[model samples]
Every structure is written in structure tokens, then in C-alpha cells.
Target: MSTFLNLLVYGLADGAILALAALGFVLIYKATSVINFAQGEFLLVGAYMFYTAFVVLGLPLVAAVLVGVVVATLIGVLVERFILRPMIGEDPISIIMVTIGLSMLLKALVQMFYGTSPKSQPAILPRSSVEFLGATVPLNRLLVILIAAVVLTAFTIFFRRSRHGIAMRAVADDQQAAMTMGISVRRIFALAWVLAAVSALIAGVLLADISAVDQNLAGFGLMVFPVVILGGLDSVPGTIVGGLIIGLLTQFVSGYQDPGLATVVPYVVLVLILLVRPYGLFGETRIERV
Candidate 1:
């Protein structure tokens, strides 16, 4: 039916953005074994950065994007070098606390600078609709899917073939073995943070393009937790699968049931997935002899 098709398109678009955000989370965990509670704030900051550059400073769209990417890269490097670096070798609880604190700090900084009002984002994608399979699909939504797919594909190729990508994978597999192979674990950690930041930045911008830029953008990023958990915390491919499943489910529930119920659906799925398969659909199972 047309209604189902519309929901399908919307769901795919939402899932693409979710995958982008979750991808960064998985990367940092894989490389450094750190659960970055601040990942959402990264998206928040990135969105605002793009808004400031494009709207406030009147920069061209491409220039604004570049500026956002540069700032994101710096934030990642600084966090890895100054904040997270010192906590290396510390207790996992301590690291988690630090990240949680970082998230608050980043959110506070954004609030101080921008306040809580939602800003009108410049339209990057055309605000139009097209008929597809008897369903009216927003042109922007279709563009979002295309863009996300391209970016994800590019990353997949990089990971499978590039030297640095292989090194990153090597480090993720076993830090000690990677070190013995002459890979700098520290460098890989930094790279992971940088990539994560960039991916979050793209997701933030796309989200803001679809919706208004607001504080709630960070909250939306928190949805990544359920996504990565569903897909597999350390599984790169899991992010995509999990994202699509969650995205489609949310849209369908919102369309057929109460919109309010949609908000709770993801968490419910999260709990069920945890009970059924704690390792996630694509997550690896580790068995250690005690």
C-alpha cells in the first residue's frame, strides 16, 4: 500500500542517519575499548558548527561543511590526546565517568553559546516530493539515503583495503599482537576518534537538514545506544542492519499506532535483544577460560 511505502522510505532515511551515528560509537569502542558517552554531543556540536558557519557567517554550503569537518577532527584529536589519553589504563568505570562528564561539558558549552532555541537550518536538500511505487517520498529523504549509502560504502572499502584501515582492524583484533606487528595503538586510537567525529558530524548535519537544529539533537544521538546494541557493539556491519531495523520499526509503529509509542519501541526492543542475545545480532561472542 501507499502508506506502507511511505513509511518504508522514511524508515530507510532515518536508519541511514542512525547507522552513521552508531558507526562512530563502534569505531571508538573497537579501537580503544572506550564507550564514549559523549558521542551524542559530538553530533550536537557538529550540527551547531555547521549552522554557525552556513547561516551565521554566511559561508557557502561546501565551505560550511569543510569547516565543520575540521572542527570535528580537532575535537576528536583533543579529546583523545588530553581527556581520554590520560585515562588510558584507568578503571573502565572511571573512563566511563569521564566520558559522561565530557558529554555534560560539551552540552553545557553548546547551551552557553547557542541557548536552547531551535534554529532554522538552511535547506541543503530540495524540499520537494516525488512519487515512488505509488508512494509520495520526500526528495530530501531519498537524497539522505543515497548519501548515507555512499558514505558507508566508501568506509567499507577503506576498511577492507586501505593500509591504515587494515592497521586499525589489526589493532582492534588484538592490541598486543598489533603492537608486536609494529602498529601504533595510540595512533590508531586517535584515528578512530577522528573518524567517529567525522561520521557523527555528517549525521548531525543530515538530521538538522531534515529537522530543526535544537538541543534535542543530542538526545536523538542517544538512540545510537539501542542501535549499536542491536547490531553488535563491535560489529561494523551490525550498525547498518540494526539501524535499518530500528528505523523501520519506529516509523511503522508511529504510523499504525500512537506516535508516543514509537518513542518507547526502541528501548523495548533493546531490552528484548539483551535478554535474548546480549552479544547482538552481529556481535562476536568472547569466551575466556577463567
Candidate 2:
């Protein structure tokens, strides 16, 4: 029983991180209808930036995180404006290819500068353990979970209440209609990318805190596809729930069966979900005009 509880706790902690990563992915998709394969690279950049600022430069952790987020957000905006926006009327495959190319290029650049070697992240939170319901949890893990929850909650409120958030939603609904309504669809696209970058920064920081900082950290963005699909591509709450499911399923599979199963389970689930509901759980059901 204690063992099960332990695995569950760990899974929840991991799910929180995945959810943060997926949030950015979802935001970009919802607003611009672009599946950003380069999303993970943005995360890598933020983590590396944090490492450079906090560890190498010996700046405060908060300051480092802030700088990383700002820089990453700007990069995101620039990518959309310069790279993605130009390809706007292009085929979906072309856009996807461009994103793939961007990911490869950015990753290679990072490897050239930071090298393929992983770097240890300075502990942002205290190195302490907390006992929760008979399970020992690390303070940093608890912090990650707490921060993820807070960020999700704040964003949810913003989407529901804020004008910019509503504008984003309008743009997502129909770009043409939104433009007719005087909501600059282009601006919304840029905003989505910027927000996506910010989310990546947060996820990168949490990931670095939990493990070593490295180029591989961006791979989490790829892993998050299952979570996004499970939650419903367009549904924010679906992303959170999907992330939790994937996290717990992977943990249980590895803990109870074999470690290899942890990685495979998410793929199995993704395939099944896609087969049954191609649009996703929260995805809008398309209507045929004919």
C-alpha cells in the first residue's frame, strides 16, 4: 500500500511538469492552429539560459528564471513573426516541415554552444524532504507541483476573464471571423507563441530542478503529445487531466511491471485515443457543410 502510494505521488509530481509543458503546446495550437515541433527547443533554451544565469553567472535563482522567460518569450514572438507568419497560407505539411527544421537547427546550435554533455542544475529550492501521508516527498518536487497548479489556475482565470484571453479564443474559433470582428489574428498568433514560450520556460526550470539540465529536456515536449491528445487538444482542463493520466500510467507500469513499459504505455494510450476520437476528447466536433 505504501509502495503504491509512493508511485502515485511520484506520478502526480511528474504529471504536473508534463501539464505545464503541454499548456504551452495547447496555447499555440489553439490560437494559430500550428503544431509547433520546435516547442521543446524553446524549453531547452530557457533551461540553458537559467543554467547560464543562475549557475555560471551566479545570479539569484528568481532573477535567472525571469530573464530566461523574457528571453524565451521574445524568441518565440520572433519565430512566429519571421518564420511561421511568412508561411501562413502554406500547406500544413510545409509548416510542419519548417517546424521540424527549426527544431533541428536550434538543437544543433545549442549543442555547439553548450555541448552534448549534461550540466547539473543548482538547487533552486531547499534540499529537504517532506513526509506526506506516509510517503517521503522531496521539497523541490512539492514546489514543482505547487507552481504548476498555481500557473494553471491563473491561466484558466485569465482565459475566462481577461480581454486578451478572450481575444485569443475568438481568433481560435475562426481567424476570418475574428479578423472581421477587428481582432488582429496576427497579434493573437504572436501572443500564443509568446505565451507558449513562457510556459516552456517554467517547465524547463522545473525539469532542471528535478533532473540535470540538458538538451534532452526539450524531448518532454514530444512526450507531452499523448497528454494533450488525451485531454482534448483544444481543452485546457483536458491537458491537465491527460497529463495526470499519462504520468500515473507510466509510473504504475514501470513500478509494477517493467521499467520499459513506462515509455510504451503512453504510446499505446495515444494510439487507442486517436483511433476512437481523432479530434480528441475536448476537440471540437467538425460539421460537414455538404
Candidate 3:
């Protein structure tokens, strides 16, 4: 029972981070209809930026976070403006190829600057354990869950109530109609990238806090694909549901089976989900008359 409880807590924390990463992916897809292969690289860049600021420059935690966010925002804007903007009307395959190139470029840049090594990440959350429901839960893990909840809630409110958020949704629904309504699709695209970058930044920092700052952080970001696919590629709420499911499943597999199996399980689930429901659990089904 205690083991199960521990796994539950750990899984939830992992899922929260997954959801954060996946949220950005969903936002970009919804707003731009473009799948960003470089989303994981964003996570890598954000984590490294935070590491440089906090560990290298010896800045306060808050300041380090701000630095990371600002840098990520800039990266988002630059990518959208310079790289993506030029290819706006290009073939989807070309856009995807460009993003793949972008990912490699970003990863190479990080490697060039930081080298391919793991750095000791300072603990931002309390590194203690607390008993919950007869289970010993790491205080840091609990704090991660709390922080992710707050951030997700804030995003949900923004999407539901804010004017810009409504415009974003409008654009996502129909670009032509949104344009007719006087909504700037280009501006929304930029905003989507910015939001995605910020979300990835937060997820990267939280993940680094739990683990170490390493190039493998980007690999963790790749796991967001399974989460978003499981939840629904364009469904924001689905990201949360998918994240929790994947997180719990990974934990359970690792605990009861081999830890190695946990790594393969998500992809396995991805395949099964694709075969059974390509649209995902909460993804909307589109029907077009050919």
C-alpha cells in the first residue's frame, strides 16, 4: 500500500510536468496548424538557460527563472518571426522539416555552449519527506504537484476569460473566419509560440529540480508526444488527462515490472492508441467530404 502511494505521488508529479510540456505543443498546433518538432529543444534550451543563470551566474532563484523565461520568450519570437514566418504558405512537410532542422540546431547550440554533460541542479523545492495517507512523499514532489496545478489553473482561466485568449481560440477554430472577424492570425501565432515557450520553460525548470540538468532533459520532452497524443493533440484539457495517465502507468510499470520497461511503455501505449483511436481519448474527430 505504501509502495502504491509512493508511486501515485511520483506519477502525479511526473504527469504534471508532462502536461506542462504537452500544453505548449497543443497550443502551437491549435493556433498554427503546424506540428513543432522542436518543442523538446525548447525544454532543453529553457533548462540550460536557467542553469546558466542560477548555477553559473549565481543569481537568486527568482531572477534565474525570470532570465530563463525572458530568453525563452525571445527564442519563441525569433523562431516565429524569422524561420516560421518565411515558410507560412509552404508545404506542411517542408514546415515539419524546417522544425526538425530547428530542433537539431537548438540542441547543437546547447551542446556547443554547455557540452554534453549533466550538471548538478540546485533544489528549488524543500528536499524533505512528509507522510501522507501512510505514504512517505517527498516534499519536493508534493510541491511540484502544487506548482503545476497553480500554473495549469492560471492558464485555463486565461484561455477562458482573457480577450487575447479568446482571439487565440477564434483563430484556432477558423483562420479565415478569424481573419474576417478582424483577428490578426499572425499575432495569435506569435502569442501561441510565446505561451508555448513559457510553459516549456516552467516544465524544464521543475523537471531539472526533480532530476539533474542534462541534455537528456530534451529526451524527457519527447515524452510529451505520447501525452499529447493520448490526451488529444489539439485538446488542452486532454493534455492534463493524458499526462496523469501516462505518468501513473510509467510509475506502476517501473515499480512492479522492470524500470527499463517503463521507458518503452509510453511508446507502446502510443502505438496502441493510434491503432485504436488515432484522434486520442479527448481529441476531436474531423470529418471532411472528399
Candidate 4:
């Protein structure tokens, strides 16, 4: 029983991280229809930037996070404006290839600047644990969950209430109509990219605390695909719930299944969901008649 509780708590924590990362991915996809393959690289860059500011430059933790987020957001905006915007209305295949190329470029750039070695992040939180539901939970894990909840709630409100958020939604619904209504589709795209970067920075910093920061940090970006698809591409709430489901399912499978089966658990779940729902749990349905 203790072990089960421990796994559940830990799984939830891990899911929180995954969900945060997926939130950025979903935001970019929803607003601009651009599948950013470089999303993970943006995260890697932000994490490393935070580490450099906090650890090497001796800046305050809060200040470092702010700077890192700003830098990451700028990087995101520049990439969209210079690289992606130029290819707008081009073949989807061409856009995809360009993003793939950009991802590779960012990876190489990170390696050149940060080197291939991993760096340990300075601990921002004190080492501690608390007992909850008859299980010992790390304070850091609990903090991660709380932070993710706050960020998710804030984003939901932004989309529902804020002017910029409404504009983004309009653009997503129909670019032509949005442009005709005096909304700048280009500006909305830029805004989406910037927001995605800020979200990635937060996730990266939190993740760096849990583990070492290195190139491998970006690989976690791949995990977002399953979470977003499971929850439904455009559903923000679905992203959070789907992330938890995948996180818990992965942990349970790893705990009970043969080692090999554990590795493929996510794919198994994704395949099953795709087969049944096709559009996903909350994905928008499209009806076509010819």
C-alpha cells in the first residue's frame, strides 16, 4: 500500500512536469498551426540560461528566472518571425522540414555554447519531505505540482478573459476571418510563439531542479506529443488530464510489467486512444462531404 501511494504521488509529480511542457506545445499549435519541432530545444536553452544566470552570474533566483524567460521568449519570437513566417502558406511539408532543420541547428548551437556535458542546477528549494496520505513526498515534487497548477490556471484565465488571448482564439478559429476583423494574424502568431517560450522556460527550470541540465533535457519534448494527442489537440483542460493519465499509466506499467513492456507503455496507450477516438478526447471534429 505504501509503495502504491508513493508511486501515485511521484507519478502525479512527473505528470505535472509533462503537462507543463505540453501546454506550451498545445498553445503554439492551437494559435498558429505550427508544429514546433524545436520546442524542446527552446526548453533546453531556457534551462541552461537560468542555470548560467543563477549559478555562474550569482544572480538572485527570481531575477534569473525572469531573465531566462525573457531571453527564451525573444528567441521564440525571432524564430517565428524570421524563419517560420517567411514560409507561411507554403507547403506543410516544407514548413515541417524547416522546423526540423531549425531544431537541429538549435541543438548544435547549444552543444557549441554549453558543451555536451550536463550541469547540476543549484537547489532552489530546501531538501525536505512531508508525509501525505500515508506516503512520504518530496517537497520539491509537491512544489512542482503546485506551480504547474498555478500556471495552468493562469493560462486558462488568460485565454478566456484577456484581449490578446481572445485574438489568438479568433486567429485559431479562422485566420482569414480574424484578419478581416482587423486582427493581425502575424502578430498573433508572434504572441503565441513568445508565450510558448515563457511556458517552456518555467518547465525547464523546474525540470532542471529535479534532474541535471543537459542536451537530453530536450528529449522530453517528444513525450508531449502523446499527452497532447490523448487530451485532444485544442482542449487545454484535456492537456492537463491527459498528462496525468499518461504519467500514472507509465509509472504503473513500469512498476508491474516486464521491463521491456514498461518502455512501450506510452505508445500502447496512445495507439489505443487514437484508434478509438481518432480526433482525441476533446479534439474538434471535422465533417466533410463530397
Q: Against the true structure, what is each candidate's TM-score?
A: 0.97, 0.95, 0.97, 0.95
Measured by TM-score, the strongest candidate is 1
Per-residue lDDT of model 3, residues 87-122, tens digit only: 998999999999999999999999999999898877
lDDT of all predictions: 0.94, 0.85, 0.93, 0.84
Better of 3 and 4 by TM-score: 3
Residue 260 lDDT in candidate 2: 93
Candidates 3 and 4 compared: the better one by lDDT is 3
Q: Quick one: best lDDT, which candidate?
A: 1
Order the candidate numbers by lDDT, best to worst.
1, 3, 2, 4
Estimate, for each residue in 187-234, the C-alpha lDDT of model 2 and write its tens digit: 999999998888888888888888879877878768788988888888
RMSD of candidate 2 to the truth, in angstroms, is 1.7
Cα lDDT of model 4 by residue, 1-290, tens digit: 87787778767877887888888888888987878787787778878889989988889988998889879879878988899899988988888899889879988988998899998776886569888888787888788889988998999999999999999999989899998999999899999888888888888888888777888888877778788889988778878998888878887777767657755777877898889986778787765798
Model 2 lDDT at residue 220: 73
Report model 4's TM-score to 2 decimal places. 0.95
Model 2 earns a TM-score of: 0.95
Q: Give the candidate order by descending TM-score.
A: 1, 3, 2, 4
**Candidate 1, poorest ten consecutive residues by summed lDDT:** 281-290
Worst 10 residues of 2 by lDDT: 279-288
**Local distance difference test, candidate 4:** 0.84
Off by over 4 Å in 3: 287-290
